[model samples]
Target chain A: MATQQTQLLARTLLTPAVALLFIWMIVPLALTIYFATLHYNLLDPGSESFVGLENFRYFLTDPAFLASLQNTLVLVGSVLAITILLGVPLALLLDQQVVGLSIVRLMVIAPFFVMPTVSALVWKNLLMHPVSGLFAWIAHLFGLPAIDWFNDAPLFSVILIISWQWLPFATLILLTALQSLDEEQKEAAEMDGASALSAFIYITLPHLARPITVVILIETIFLLTVFAEIFVTTGGGPGLQTTNIAFLIYSQALIQYDVGSASAGGLVAVVLANIVAFFLVRIVGRNLEA
Target chain B: MARMVTTRHKVISTVAAWLVGFLIFFPILWMVLASFKTELEAFAIPPSFLFFHWTTENYVTVQERSDYLHHALNSIIIAGGSTLIAMLIAIPAAWSMAFSPTKRTKDVLLWMLSTKMMPPVGVLVPIYLIYRNLGLLDTRTGLVFILCLGNLPIVIWMLFTYFKEIPKDILEAARMDGATIGRELIYVLTPMAVPGLASTLLLNLILAWNEAFWTLNLSTLEAAPLTVFIASYSSPEGLFWAKLSAASTLAIAPILVLGWFSQRQLVRGLTFGAVK
Candidate 1:
């Protein structure tokens, strides 16, 4: 039996959360939009003036913007590719009967739990340092030159570190999906004399599609704004070689003290993320009814 | 012949899985090992795999030299405080949506999730400026406020999903018995909802603990958590490999244990119940 009292109570219960999130989302965003059109610089006070679209124009034309935009895309795209490609096989392997399964799963998933700064610094100094890193030592053992990771291929290093962190996430999701698969369906496939490869191509991957999409969308949202790894490892450098959009906006506002340009860059990032969010919201929306 | 083949198959796959797992886990394992070594041996060329003179000196040095406990305490307060507040705010909202179906409930949930998608950097400038003007920068209160808001959507979503699973029949049964609403919550609902609430709390705690952007941007020293504290080592001073390893080991050890416990809930919470 529906009652007006219950509905009113429900709205009352929801009011605080709704109102708080509303303010949290709107206030900063409104400020960002307002700040974007100004010539605001924290360093030089009282220089604030209306500079409509000039900040955007400068930010759009800046070489750092283009490079960072490319870096952001490459970082996101490469990590996605690596995680999915490796995750599928890893998930499949884990789904098999294995001794010490729990321990293996823990070990496999351990890196995702490591904080970004710790992982980045560890990889930088402990394993990737040219002169003394484990990788260098291993190369030296083979009578090869120690390849400098951060200096030589900073973006690649960042990509590799992030991929390591995300691989566990992809694998864990895919594995969960794989575990739920009907055993009878797999048996039915085997009875049809389906080769393992064919069964995987047909039964396994198709079952995995939804979860894979979930993994991709969720990971993309986080990956597109990967800041901590870049912050600690390269500081967006060797030059601007490893700067992503998130880090780019950060430098503009905080380091360069250019709020107007930073706000514009911030909106650009919001637009890019919203494009991904559009698809994600649709998918999650569809699932809400289920 | 069939049994032998099955055994062989399991053996080969297990071996392969272990190899890959070890490879994936090698970096973290190597770091943990380095934490146990002396400064000279931490980054020594031809890195020692085993049989090194293990020492606990780095751990002691890291704490004594750098006030590790202070940052650790900050992490506890910030993460713990945010999780508690988010849970408090979210539980009511999630409970209402779960119990009372409205035409707009779906829209509200999706809208909330959309807020999370707005990249934090998009609003970093305003937040920084606002915090500065309000004198909230470098304060645990500011971190808690921001993080609580940031994670509220997730908390609500997770709790909503969990609450939705509690069968409506039981609550109706309790209502029909003339139990008051408050009594119904305290008696019937709380028991079943406890697991969901706990999991959501654990997962949100982990997320807040590792959050870097706002913490890094806003807090300098007074309120820097282990994330900021560990990042401080990334400067030229990061050359102290043993100390870095020791600090990192301490930083991740608690969360890793907590994370492992909450892995199942993590997938559900992170994916917004999309996969589950």
Candidate 2:
């Protein structure tokens, strides 16, 4: 009887959080879906007529949409590739018995904590600036011409900044996974006259598969909505070269005040993200059980 | 098992690892170095690594130009307020779920996690309109509310994971000893859950401090945090590299220290316990 009473009390305690999250998730999302089908402009208040699928048609067919969509894919894909590729070797390197290991680990993980705006500006002005940046100084020393990073390659520059921020996360996760590798299995493989390359390929690579997937999925979710870096450095410009979908919708709703189309675009982004989220939730859900 | 590695191998790995670490950390190191230099010296060719005459003028100038303290206070209130509020609601929820999990507990937990996966942009339009109508835009309260909601799932998840690690036998023992629910919670659970709560607080505070997207979009001046404060230097009128660096340094230094301390919890919290 006492246990039954406590269970009811537990349900009561859980109500506030559950209720708030329910409203937070449902209300605005329903509003977004509703607004996506209407001709709503924030600037012209009191003029929101139902427009059916017209807003979606316009947003999906716009050339800028295609460009931003491509930019989103390229940015997410390139950053994931760079982080994971570099993260593997770096994690392996860090896993080795090295002097001052904690200090080195701190250095590697420092960039992940720097806020996006600061990192973007620091990279833009101090490091990637054309004439006076560190890259220019390095090029001059090597008798090479300085590359104007933003002007010549805006998306690539954004990728580099973002990659720098996320590389630490990948390294830390992979390093943790690496440390958990069964040493006995590796020793057994080594005693069987397996080469170092073969041992790593056979043993270490397999062990890393799960973590690498987790890294890829988590990074993709954040990478899909990388806004602050673009907002600070490129401003989605030099002719929309750096505009991803997140910035694209931002420009639509805030800059252009086209709420109808922006909401439509937002729904599209949500759909795209849900595809990735489905897999991520499954992976995490399975882990929750164990 | 300790494999015998040659001294040369160890030396090579050490050198290579340190070199990579330095290269990765160079941008931040360069920013900190430039913050102490003059405008001209900051952009000097060959980019002085450390030999420049160091000064605190840029820090003073940045403060004078923009009221750094006001924005810093806003950051403190927003991050700190939202975290405390979320913890208040999340603790009871997570505690109950952790201790008295029902048949639907996993489903509820997964549902909460799913809310986090929804892109902020998906609901940006509605939230903006709602905020505008409610007169919450550019207000610290508004930001705090949204941030708390935004991070509520994380706070709950983290606390739940931590709470699960606490053996249930103690709580049951307390109950058997004629302890009331309130007394059990106050004297027993709270003390035992302190470390986990502290880490959760630390990780969430760092997250709230560095959240940039909503802060950038929703705030202009009144409730602008350090993120907005630093972003204002993007299109400078004159030579302001030193001041920019100084401002950027101030914005990130506190959170960076906090982040390093919570690096272990970060992986577990972020990955939803998948990696850990």
Which pairs clash in model 2? none
| Residue-by-residue lDDT tens digits, candidate 1, B53-140 | 9999999999999999999999999999999999999999999999997999999999999999999999999999999999999999
CA lDDT of every candidate = 0.94, 0.94
RMSD in Å for candidate 2, one decimal? 1.5
Q: What is the lDDT of residue B104 in candidate 1?
A: 96
TM-score of 2: 0.98
Return the TM-score for chain B, candidate 1. 0.98
True contacts kept of each: 0.83, 0.81
Q: Model 2, DockQ value?
A: 0.81
True lDDT of residue B68, candidate 2: 92
What tens digits encode model 2's per-residue C-alpha lDDT throughout B1-276?
A: 144456667888899999999999989989999999999999888778888999999999888889998999999999999999999999999999999999999999999998999999989999998998999899999999999999999999999999999999999999989999999999999998999899999999999999998899889999999999999999982388999999989989999899999999999889988898
Instruction: List model 1 lDDT by residue over A72-133, tens digit each.
Output: 99999999999999999999999999988898999999999999999999998998898889
Q: What is the lDDT, from 0 to 100, of the residue B252 in candidate 1?
A: 95
B274, model 2: CA deviation in Å? 0.3
Model 2 lDDT at residue A109: 97
